[model samples]
Target: MPDIVNHTFENMSTAQPHYDVIIAGAGPVGLFLACELALERCAVLVLEQAADPDSPLKRMPFGLRGLSAPSIGALHRRGLLDALDLHQRMKNPFVGPSSPGAKRPAGHFAGLVFHHEDIDMSQWPDQPDGLPASLLSEMAELETVLARRACELGVTIRRGAAIAGFDQEPDRVTVHAGDETFVGGWLVGCDGARSIVRKAGGFDFAGTEPEFTGYTFSAELSGAAALKPGRNVTARGMYLQSQPGFIVLQAFDGGAFHDAGLPVTREHLQDVLRRISGSDVTIETLHLATTWTDRARQATAYRNGRVLLAGDAAHIHSPLGGQGLNLGLGDALNLGWKLAATVQGRASEGLLDTYQAERHPLGARVLDWSRAQVALMRPDPGARALRAIVGDLMATRDGATYVAGRVWGLGTAAVRIA
Candidate 1:
C-alpha cells in the first residue's frame, strides 16, 4: 500500500501534477500533518526542497528549543507520544548542554525542569536540571522522527523537490515543483515565512510585523574547568553556572539568548556574555546564527480554495515561549483530522473549511501576545522598569501560577465551528 503511493508519485507524467493531498515543506508541522493524514489512510505526498532526513544537508542545529506545555498537552491528547515514542525519542540527542565549552561531559546535568510559583532565580544549585519537563528533542531529532513517521504512514516525500508554483481548483490543487508536477485533492503550504504555497494559492498573509528580532547562537565550550558545572547556577537564565554571562545557557539548543530586538554579532555576543556572566567563555562550536525579525503577523485566513497553510507559512512572529513549531503542529492536528474526516466522507465538507475560521484568530492573538513579551525583553530604562514591575507582579503567588499556566499555553482555545 505504501509502495502504491510511491508509485503514484513517480508515475506522474506532468498530468497537471496530481495527488490525493500535496504538502509543500517537510518541517515538523508539515511532516506531522502528513503522518496524521496517512494514519487516517489518506494518500498524501510531501514535497521538500531538501534531500533525505538523515542527509547531512538537512542537518540544522537546534535553536527554537522552547516548547510550550500546551503543545505537549495537544500531542498527548492525540496519543502521539507513545505512537511517536516522543519521550524516548525526545531523549534522542536531547536538546542541549549547559555551556558550549567542554565540561565534565556532554549532555550532563539533571534536575529542576519546571517553573514554579516563586520566580526564585536563585534556586538553581538546589535543583540541577532547571525544569521538570522540557520539549527535550533538538530540532534535528524532532524533524527526523516526524519525517520517518510521515513516511511510515505512507506519505510519499520527494526531497530536493521545491514547489515552483501552484493552482487550486474547487476539488483539487495542481502543484509545480521544479520539473515535477503534482495534483492533489488538497494542498497545504508549510514552507516557512517565505511561502511559495501561500503566494501561489493567492491568499494574503495578514498581521503586523513586530518591532523586535531574535538571534540564536551556537558555540562550544572550550575550557571545561571554567564552566564544568553548567546546570548548578542561579536561575538567572538557561545555560549553566560555569558559563559566562555573555553566552547564556538559557537557550540550551545553542548557548545563546533571544536578545529581544537588539542586533548582535559574534564579537558582540561574546562581549555581552563576558559582561553579564563575568566569565571570558571561550567559543567552541560557533555553529550558526539565525536572526528572525519578530513580526506579530497572522494569515488573514488558513485556507483558500482547496489549499491550506500551516506553521510559519500561515503565520510567524517572535519565537518567544518556544511557540513557533508547537503552534504550527497544533494547527496541523486540528486541520488534519478534520480534513481527513471530510476526505473520507465521515464529516460534512464544511468541516474542512472551519480550519481557518478557528485558527486564524488564535494565530493572530499569539502574535500579539508574543509582541508584548518582546516589549518586556527590551532594555530601555522605562521598559526594564515596566518589566520588573510586571515580572514582580506575576511572581506573586497567585499571579505567577496563573501566568505560568497561560505561558504553558493551557489557557485558551479556538472557537469550534458547528
Candidate 2:
C-alpha cells in the first residue's frame, strides 16, 4: 500500500469552513496547483477518492511518461527538477545506433520517429538555456514529488474523500465529501475524465466520437517470443511491445468493447493480440489490463461561476504521443498563478478570465492533434500511404523541426484574436 497522509482540521468542531480553495482531485495537476496556491499563502484543501497514491500501473515501464520542454521548464522553475531521477536511468528508446555521428531520435508522432539532428533548435531564438527538449518521467514519481511539495507548502490533502456534490453561491462553494461538508471561497475540479464535479456542475462537454478501442496491459504469454519488438501499425490494428510481457493494442472496434463497459479478461486479450499481431499468442496469465478509446471531449468552459475545472476535468483526449498528462500539467501551470492571483485579490479585471480564453484554444488544438493521429492510424491504404509520406517528411530537417516544436510545446507567441 502507498503511504497516505491525511490532514484533519483542528476546527472541525466549528461551523465555519476554514479553507480558501477546495480542489476535487489529488492527481498531479491538482497537487501542483495546490502547491502554487500554498506558495502564495492560500489555504488549500485537496480531496481525493484514492486512499493510497501508489499503483502498479504507475511503476516502471508501464508508467513511463515523456516530459516535454515546457513541462521540464515548469518543474525547473519550481526548483523540483533535480528531484527527478528516472530520466537519467531509463534507456532512451529513440537513441538510434550508437555508431560514430549517430543522430539520437527525439520523439515520435503516430510511431514516426523524429531525430535530434533534424530538429533545428536555432529556430527557437527565445528558447531558455540548459533545458533538454524532452525528458522521461514516471507518473508515480511525479505525483509523489508534487504531493510532497504541496504538503510542505501547507496544502492539506484528504484521502478517500471523494467530492460527492457541490453547491456554488455568489462568493463561495460548498463541497460535500463523505459525511462532512467543506466550504471554500472557490472550487476547482481537477478530477479526471469522468469528473463528478463536471457532471454535477452541468458543464457542456463537446467532442468527436471514438474511432477505436485501445488497450494497455501486462500478461504472461507463451508465444510472445514470436512477436517482434517496438510499435507495429498493422492493417488489422496496431500493437506495441515496449517490453516483454507488456503490450499495447489498438483494435478498430468503433469503441464498442470500451463503451460496453465489460471487464478485460485473458480471453479478450488473447483474441485481440492474435488478431492484431496475426500470431497465435496465448495468454497464460493476465497480470493487468485497462481499456480506453479516442473519444475526445473538452468542457466548453473551464470555469462555472466559483467552481472551475482543470486537467482531465476540463479536457480529455487519446493518449497519443503521451499528451494527456502533458496537456493537463499545462492547464495547471497556466491556471495556477492566474487563479491564485484572483483568489488573493491581486488579479486585474480580466486576468481570471484569461485562464479559459488562453487554455481553451490549446485544449482544442490538443484534441485535434489526437484526432489527426487517429485519422492516420486508420487501417486503410490511404492512411498507410499518408503515414509513409509523413514518415518521409519527419526525416527531413524542416519537417522534424516543425513537429518537434509542436510536440515540445514551443515557438508560440501569445496572439490576440479580436
Candidate 3:
C-alpha cells in the first residue's frame, strides 16, 4: 500500500486542496473504496453527513450482516480480514430448528433454512474447502475496521460534511458541503439509499414497490413463549425470534406502515406481532426498533458524467438474504481499482466504463433475487404453495448448492484487467 499524504500532482492549483476522488458517505463501502484508491496511490476524501457514526442499530442484533464469499475474499486479499474479530466472538445469529442429530443450518432464503449438510461442496470446485462461504459481521465493527484502514492509507474523512450538491466540469468536480467547497477529479456516491449525489446527478432509479413492511426490534415480551423459536411463516406473514428479546417480523401490509414513516411504538408493534403471529404476545417494553421493506430499486445508470454511485446509493432491495452489503462491497472492490487507474491517467480507453457494465447486471440480479423472496413470502395460498415447493427443492443437494452459490456470490464472474 502507498501512502497518499505526500503525493504531489504537477500543474495542479495549490491555493486549495484538490483530491483525486471525493466520495460521499463514510459508511463501509465509501471507506473501503477510499482504502482501495489510496492503496493505488490516489488521494481520496470521504464526506459524511452524520456527525457521529455510533448508533444502536449498528450494534448487535440489528447490525448483524452476513459476509458473502466475495466479500470475505476481498477483505482477505486486502489484509483487513484479520482486523475483524466479531465473527470469532459471535456465532451465527440466524436460528433454525435444533435437534440432537440434525444438520446445522448454514443460511436461509425467505426464512427457509438450508443446512450445511445439504450444500454439496463438490459442485463448487472453485471454492476451496477451508474458506468460509459466509461470515457474520456487525456494521459498526466493519465500518470501524475499514475507516481505520482508510485513514492509515491517508484517506481524508470529513464528518458533519454532507454533500449538498456538486457541479461537474470537463476536468474536475466542484462539491458543495456545508459552507465549504472542495474540488476532485471525480466523485463517487456511497451515501446510502437517500443519496444527495445520485439525485443531484440525475440518475434514474427504477424498481418495484414493496410487498411488506418488515420490522427488527429488541423488546421485553410478557408472553414470549407463544412465539416459537426460530422462524415461523404463518398464514398472515413471517416472524422470527432469533433470541430471547430480538425479533424480526414481516407483515404483508404492502409496505404501508414503513412507508407511512410512523414511529414503532410498543402498542403498534404488539398489534402487528399479534396479528402476524396469531398470538397474544405482549411487547412489555420496546428497547430498539427499525423498519424496512422489500421495495427493490436500481439506478438505470451507475455513472453520470464525473459522478458515480456505489452501495445503497446505486441499488437497494430487501435484506432478505443479506446480499446488500456484499453487493455494495463488491461494487467498491470492482470500481476502486478501475477509478483509481482512470484518475492516475493509467487506464486504457473505456476502462472506467466497464464498472457499470459488470456491476449493473449483478445488482439487477440481486434485486430480482430479493423480489423473488418477497414473492415467496407473500401471505397468500399461491405463495405458500410455491414456498413449499421451493422448500422441497432447497432440501436437495443440487438445489442447495445452487442457492448457496447465489447467496455466497460464488458464481460471480471474475473481471481481470489485461
Candidate 4:
C-alpha cells in the first residue's frame, strides 16, 4: 500500500483548502511528479485544461513515443514499469535492413538508421543485460498508467480546469483556473510549449526559430508504393511512409504553414507530399493529421519566486530524436523528491534551488541536440554534405556507440537524490 497523507483541514469549511503543491497540466510529467510527491506524504493537486483524456492523436502511430533508458529506469525504481503493457504487443515500427543476415534496427539519429548489432553494450556496462535501452509506448497508455498511480497515491486531479492566471505570494500561490480558484504552497507549470504559467510568471523563453514545418498524417493514398518503406531524405525534403496509410513529411517552408494556423486539409497535405516525395501521390481520404516544427527554446530560469516550471513548460525542442519526453520525465524525477523534502521541512537550505541548477544545463544540451539534427536535415547542399560525413561516421563502432549513448540517454549525468 502507498503511504498517504491524512489532512485535517478537510473538515474545516471556514478555512480555504490548501495543498502542498498545485501542478498545472496532467501530462505524464505532471502526473508522475504528483505520484512522486504524494509518495512522500505531500498533498498534491493536479489541474488539467483538457476535459476528456481521449483523443485520436493520443491513440496509435500519432501517439507513439520512445522511452529512453533513464526514463525506463525511473519507472522501474518507482515500480510503475511493469504496469505498461503496450510494448508487449506493439512491434517497433522503425525498421532497418531487410537482408537475412543484417542487424536489426535499434534507433536513428537525424533519420539515419542504426542497427542493434552496432551498439557496443560493453560501453554501457551499468545497463544490465536483458534490460531494454529503449522501449516504444503510446502517449495515451502512458498517461493512463501515470494517472492511475497518482490517484493511488492520494493525489487529487481536477480536469477541465485551465489555469487562467496565478498570483504568487511569499507563502502561497493562488491559481485562477476557469471559474474556480486554488491555493497551494508551490505552483509547477508542466503545461506544454505554450504554457500560460510560464508566460504569466514572466519566464524568459529563448531559442532558435524553426527551419521547417513537419507533418505527420494518416491518409489513404494512391501510388503509395512510389514512396520508400523507411525514412527517405529527398532533394526537396524528407518523407517516410511508415505504413501503407501512415506518412510523415518535412517541408522546408520556414514554418510558415504551421505559424499561419492554416487548416491541414487534404489538398495541402497532398501538395506537400507530392513536392517533398517528388511523386504524384493522391490523398484519397485524409484521416488524422498534425503539424509541428523544430523550434528549440528553453526558459532562462525555471523558477520565479514560488512558481516553477517542468516538462515542455521548462524547455522545448524538435521531436527529432524523441528526447523531449525523456528530458521532461528526468526533470520531474529530479524535482519531485527535492520539492517534497522542502515542503516537509526536512530539506537543507537551498535544496529547492538546485532544481534549476541541475536541470537547466541538461535542457540546454537537449535543445542544442535537436538543433544539430535540424541542421543536418536541411535540404541544402551544405547539409547534404554534412549528412554524408555524419553517415560515414555513424557506420563506425565508435560513432555508433556515441550516437547510441546520446539517443538512449546513457550519456546524461545521473542526478541521484537520496
| Leading candidate by lDDT | 3
Q: Candidate 3: deviation at residue 259, Å?
A: 1.3
TM-scores for every candidate against the unseen true structure: 0.72, 0.94, 0.94, 0.95
Candidate 2 per-residue lDDT, tens place, 230-327, comes to 77889998888888898989999899999999999999889999999999989999999999999999999999888889999999988888877878
The whole-model lDDT of each prediction reads 0.60, 0.84, 0.87, 0.86
How do the residues 245-359 of candidate 1 rate in per-residue lDDT, one tens digit apiece? 2233322212223434345566755554454345667665565555555666667878887788999999987655556777787788788888888778898758887787778
Model 4: per-residue Cα lDDT over 233-288, one tens digit each: 88899997767889888999898898989999999999999999889989999999
Q: Which stretches of candidate 2 lie over 4 Å from their true place?
A: 1-4, 8-16, 89-102, 412-418
Off by over 4 Å in 1: 1-17, 52-64, 77-79, 82-114, 117-134, 220-285, 414-418
Counting clashing residue pairs in each candidate, in order, gives: 37, 0, 0, 0
Residue 97, candidate 1: alpha-carbon lDDT? 48
Report residue 127 deviation for candidate 4 (angstroms). 1.2
Runs of candidate 4 exceeding 4 Å displacement: 1-16, 89-91, 95-97
Clashing pairs in 3: none
